[model samples]
Target: MGLRRLDIDRAALLTALTARDEGLLGTWLDLRDGTLRALVEPDDEAFEARLESESDHYVKVPLFTREFRLMAEFVEQVDDDELAVRLDQALAGPSAFRAWEGVLAADPSEQRHWRAHRESALEQWAASWLAGIGLTAPWTDEVPAPEVPALLALVMDGPVRRALGSDAEAHTTYVRACRDLCELLREPFPSRRVRSASRFARGPVVIERSGRDVTIRLRADDEAG
Candidate 1:
């Protein structure tokens, strides 16, 4: 194992402490009180395992703490064999990013044709996740009725135009909505196993059922245009 001095940014810490989220506040207090030491000092295998078990929706302080802890382990390279095994385990699992990719892959429509629909679905999925964590934001309503190519292009490429076009406004709104949602969903944890057969559907679909009626919704790419 290799060890390196961990540097904490005092200004960033203070900023996080004053943030609105309670989770962030708790993380800052934990850092000040040295509760984060255990995460940073462990061997790479242990450190990675702990992180894998952590939820993705964390506040800034926890996010920073988790990142720093992982980085410390990376710097130390303790037990290459164990590290390799953990890395493989981590990679084999379904990650939030993987879900995002699955959403893209499940889309059967041409990229140029279904950009707006896909974008709308992505925004809605993210908003729903944020709401689950008590971060209530307005839902998006940019799913324009079926349109001609030129009109679609105008709407899809609205981000490129500074003018107040539907696409531009939609893109701006969706981007902000996604950012807020991302802050709430930064961690990558294991999702419930989705049925292999249902992986091709569009929008967000429930893939697997666990205890109760809880169904894990996964993003798929093949949404209706």
Candidate 2:
């Protein structure tokens, strides 16, 4: 009878690929049959010892740091300017990875988006790595762009106007815009930045969200008019 060739356990491999911690148990490919075994640090000492002896039946799974690209690409695609800026900050300095996790954890909305992005990247990354090692991916390699939320899309495409005007649709659109705009600026808006923005205003009207507060104010230019 011919040998049974099992497909690789892709989910486990993807987890290993995305691991940033030093204690990760490595993902191993089983030669006996196409499958995987993960050995995390400080656990399963018996398997760890036997791993070297069983090299004929297993090999270290192919690896890459492709998952690290998640934060970089996610920051670029973020629709919220403030959130994008925060993500950029988290991607820098010695504690970047931890900082990024903290930031993502605080914002559940963006965290969900981040997970979707990570999943797509992980799938593509695994599929590519599997291909390099002459294994067929159980899934497609095509990573679709992370979907933009409908409210965020509306905010980005919303018309920039001085007033909501009298139209019912305009009022409806403005309410939605206000809600989404608040999400973009969840913290206090500095007065200095407000002044800077006022200098460039087409009209002296600004709609702003500070924490949970939403306010409409007249700009310096329009204040005197």
Which is the leading candidate under lDDT? 2
* TM-score, candidate number 1: 0.20
Off by over 4 Å in 1: 1-110, 138-225
What's the CA RMSD of model 2 in angstroms?
A: 20.4
TM-score of each: 0.20, 0.51
Task: State each model's CA lDDT, in order.
Answer: 0.33, 0.57
**TM-score attained by model 2:** 0.51
Q: Which stretches of candidate 2 lie over 4 Å from their true place?
A: 1-5, 20-25, 40-56, 141-225
Question: What tens-digit string does per-residue lDDT give for candidate 1 at 1-225?
Answer: 222122333334433432345322233222122233222322455545444564342222323223223323332442456543444444446683343334435433422233444344344433343333334323332322322323223334322223234644544433333332223343222223212121222122222222222222334356441
lDDT of 2 by residue, 165-187 (tens): 44454444444444333223221
Residue 83 displacement (Å), model 2: 0.9
RMSD of candidates 1 onward, in order: 21.1, 20.4
